[model samples]
Target: MFNDRPFPVDAFPKIIRNAIYEVEQHTQAPQGLIAASVLGVISLACQNRIDVCRLNNLRSPVSLFLLTLAESGERKSTVDKLLMKPLYQLEENLFEKYTHDLTIWKNDEAIFNIEKKALMLKLKSDIQRNKDYFATNEKLKDLLQSPPKAPVRFKLIFNDATPAAIKDHLCGYWRSVGIMSDEAGAIFNGYTLNELPFINKMWDGATFSVERKSEPEKLIRNARLTLALMVQPDVFKGYLQRKGEAAKGIGFFARCLICQPDSTQGSRKISSPVVSSEHLPVFHQRLMEIVNDNITLDNKNDRLCLRFSLEAENRWIEFYNKVESDMGFFGSLSNCKDYASKVAENMARVASLLHYFNGNDGDIPLSAIEDAVKITTWYVNEYIHLFSKPNEFTLAITEGDELYWWIKNHCNRHVVPYITKNTILQYGPNKFRNRSKANELLNMLQSQNKILIGKRGKTTLIAIANLKPAI
Candidate 1:
């Protein structure tokens, strides 16, 4: 199916457009591919900040899990390097600061423990004396109550990390961070990724507790994560084959804004001129402004928040109602209704991200909200086009389709309408080592009015229905 409503390119932020133009100048990739990369950069910069804002009485963390599908030579790595320079630079600076601070903290913590042990001994002695003990005990208790605050590392980016490691990073470093990978196969293909419980919880900004026998239970709160990954379709298909429907059942894929860009392969005519370096400096400067903002902690030591504008709120109400109705009514989105249902929330999140890109810490504007709506709609349509099949049926449908194509190609080459049982059993699509599986596919194709199956002299035969003459 064609994507009738393509991405709203004009609705993207000016900086995003500029960034895309810059990359396309050199990469010769499609605009959508470049735009998706730029969006990843924006998502990384503003995931934590705009998550503090609310729309339509619903406050959602602005964490976007974006997956851009392209072939190996689509220049995904090139675009990622160009767009993600600021984040890498910021992470480097943060590492330097954290290293220095951690050293100081360890020193302070060791000294404080020594002082605390001495105070405990003195308090014990005073209690034993039982005379003038009350005053001394009170002083020691006061001192213990105000122990030094522990220092925290502030990190923003992680690559190829396990959920446990990510939790630890979010708990020890900044409350918000991103898992960014150019080759997403590392994250998706890793065995630990099958049961991604942490990602499911963190995306919702829900609090989680990790119990440890050797240490105190760790409570994680206000955790936000942005995911940006570029994956080859073959790798993603392998993931689907390995994980089956489990990934979708657990809402792993549902959380992702998947973009399958039309290939730019075979389109490169000649080397294009390099993009001007001037655009990136300003882009980096703006990104740095947000990164440098002081993240204020709440009473619970979590980040503070902003709210939505009146116009934005009203628009959300309308959009939410429409999408809800479409989900209930539209057959096209039936299998992906769970993901499609989130379009409104995701739009508001994108709007908040765009709003914060301009360094605004206040209400999200109607303009940004509208633009987000357009973009989210495009994504939802794309999602339906790509993943509209029920999880359980996907494997069967995909296999059946592949079988049809393989048989068609083989028949055309051999100039035969029907394939012999022995040949098909050994060399057919899916190579029916299990004859029952081949029968199942034949039954499925029969139901679809695409093929006919018969048995002759203990040999099962397959033939295309309404077979066309070889051209």
Candidate 2:
């Protein structure tokens, strides 16, 4: 599910055509009638907007054109292009439609405007004809309730009894809990908005709520002794409601985190689901700063360990080899033993901070020490081998001179960086071998380098780089 392929645009036309065919076959209408009504629906697409009512007629012909493409299974790939042509055609004639000698409802208008009205009329006529042939099923009658054309109800309640002290304890309180719901409103449908303290009130206040409402009257009136057992029970709870200008933007709703189902009933989920990009800018920047500070803290003097620094000028240099990083541009430490030790110690503090936050093992390991040695050795070889054509990797992780010459030969001919890993990535060594992953990587390597030249313990005697780029 994480990596599902996107639906191919080319298949859309065919997919829509099939849906139309399936619906038509089920309805058993004359082919002409079913096809015509489908076209009408497509043509009406551009007219559905409440704000763009002026386009009601103007968009009909364009909508019809889209449906035409939808019907021609092969035309799906160009669906957007097909739809844009008619709209652009209309745009080009916008001036003609507006410049009128005298105002009459239908007379003095652009060609696109006139065509739009004509298409809509055609759509209406076909729809009415198809409507008469439909079966008189009860379900159909029930579904025929024309959507109530009621004007929007903008009136809302915003009374809060929460003490100013408790409500304002935290800066993000209103958003943290559904507090605004406990407001007054003209009673509607026999239910009223609830109001109660959210903070400093536990379940002991059984009626305790930030805001809540009783269930529907029908559910309330017929309660019996076993009613609670008979039903799941309509819950009374505090929920968010918008007030003033806030409601206009948010449409009168409270998206409170505490009131969410997953976080209800004394059991609160830690960390909400991964947040969206729209709200992540400030969060991520703060997170990065914390990480940077933590790393700086970890690299303190006390933590610069050096068990793997047998060849290092100092102990702290070892730990510097780990943590390739998400983002860092810190300069490399000097070879001077004292400076390397200081840098390593400082880096260890950073590692410690990471461990503390993640609640996991945060120790500097022996494998990393070994990997650090390998990295140092590779750095030395890089200077001398910089001009070697097809630079066969010579930095052997666990080897003597024979393995070194074997690597040198491959790069001496082909123009590739021949290299091997001691510290596989920024994290240092994987003491635990992952052969399958290694082989998967091997398969991606030059196929001609198939022969395993030799072996060192469990590790393979293979060229790290040759004709291919270095690992």
Candidate 3:
């Protein structure tokens, strides 16, 4: 089944595909088991090293928001730990190194504060006595010059965090970090989910103003936030039931690469877990290299530039035009046109991610751009399935229409002028559990002039009108 898909696991980079294959050997999950995991690694790998090269005179940040829908027992957390282990190790190493520096800095700050307080006192005394205060003020200025700065607990990834906390962390990390959560509910249902405006702006690499009472307004520039969220289908469904339209309306889900692959619960079998080999170590090592690769942030705190080849540029132009065509009148993606319009940008970002993962130099390869397009196509289909409404009919309404069609076909197949209530309860396409539903459906059909419901000898009957399905 995965082999037949447009973007199969095999289409991923060799290192990523190898890692996914190794993990699947232990978990026995779906073929796309590591789809979100790969994105998680990319989120951290591309955090500071690269951005999507300009394509068709347009460029977008390589940061991505990804969601993989599965069930509770899909080993999502195990996969997360495996992919993020290198990041955790880096965090530990940084903590140990920063601990000593922070202590020394704190001692220097204490001495500096003591000297500053003494100078302030002396200056006040001199001013009150009408004495020469300029000399004392000069001493104070010298004492306060070049205040000590404590080391920050730099982090590569965060799991559960509020938007306000995320803002502060971004500032600490120079406005570049990745958010990875095995459970999406932690973020979707958190207190800061209401910070949608800030979240949206950051995702688009727009400046966001962080207001504070004590400090001046901070304008965060070139904020790149990469996210990889995994959620059970039912939890995501619940989120949709409550905040689906609102989330989509604000372009939250529109910026995501969502995949609801078939579950691999009942089919999973016990197996020996594979030990870490050079194959997996190489990928992890590369990711750590990116983490340690000193990124030269510009005045805007933006990462290094990533350029594309001429052929890749042309391919993006063709892809952009195709997407633009569908964002107009009577187009299939008119409802979610905002998402459709960003297809080219998303492709560029994906290509850059692949380019970095492959350890490539110079312009991005055409093969990477093509693969990105395929992945984006799958994302478009998933988005339509989730958000797009056709002819004012929601998925529920369309499904109800389908049920009505099945009933009509069932009656015609038996050549029965009327479909009995007992027959519908027992053998109808839906196998309705109660007669009330059948009665209400019959009433609706009667109003549409498709059927007539009548009672005959204490048994309810549905009389077919026009002898054709309403759909």
Off by over 4 Å in 3: 1-7, 55-57, 96-100, 123-138, 270-276, 294-302, 328-332, 389-471
Whole-structure CA lDDT of model 1: 0.71
**Cα deviation of 66, candidate 2, in Å:** 16
What is candidate 3's CA lDDT for residue 180? 80
* Ordered list by lDDT, greatest first: 3, 1, 2
352 in model 3: Cα distance from truth in Å? 0.7
* lDDT values for all models: 0.71, 0.26, 0.71
Which clashing pairs does model 3 show? none
Off by over 4 Å in 1: 1-6, 52-56, 112-150, 271-274, 294-307, 329-331, 360-362, 389-471
Candidate 1 is scored at a TM of: 0.74
Model 2 vs truth, CA RMSD = 32.2
lDDT of 2 by residue, 256-363 (tens): 101100001111224444433332223223333332342234222232221222332234342344322211345232222222322333232222222222222324
Clash-forming residue pairs, model 1: none
Leading candidate by TM-score: 3
- Candidate 1 lDDT over residue span 149-263, tens digit each: 6666777777876677777776664677887888888877874364467778877889989776898888888777777888886778778777847877788777878777654
Give candidates' CA RMSD values in order: 8.8, 32.2, 8.6
Candidates 1 and 2: which is better by lDDT?
1
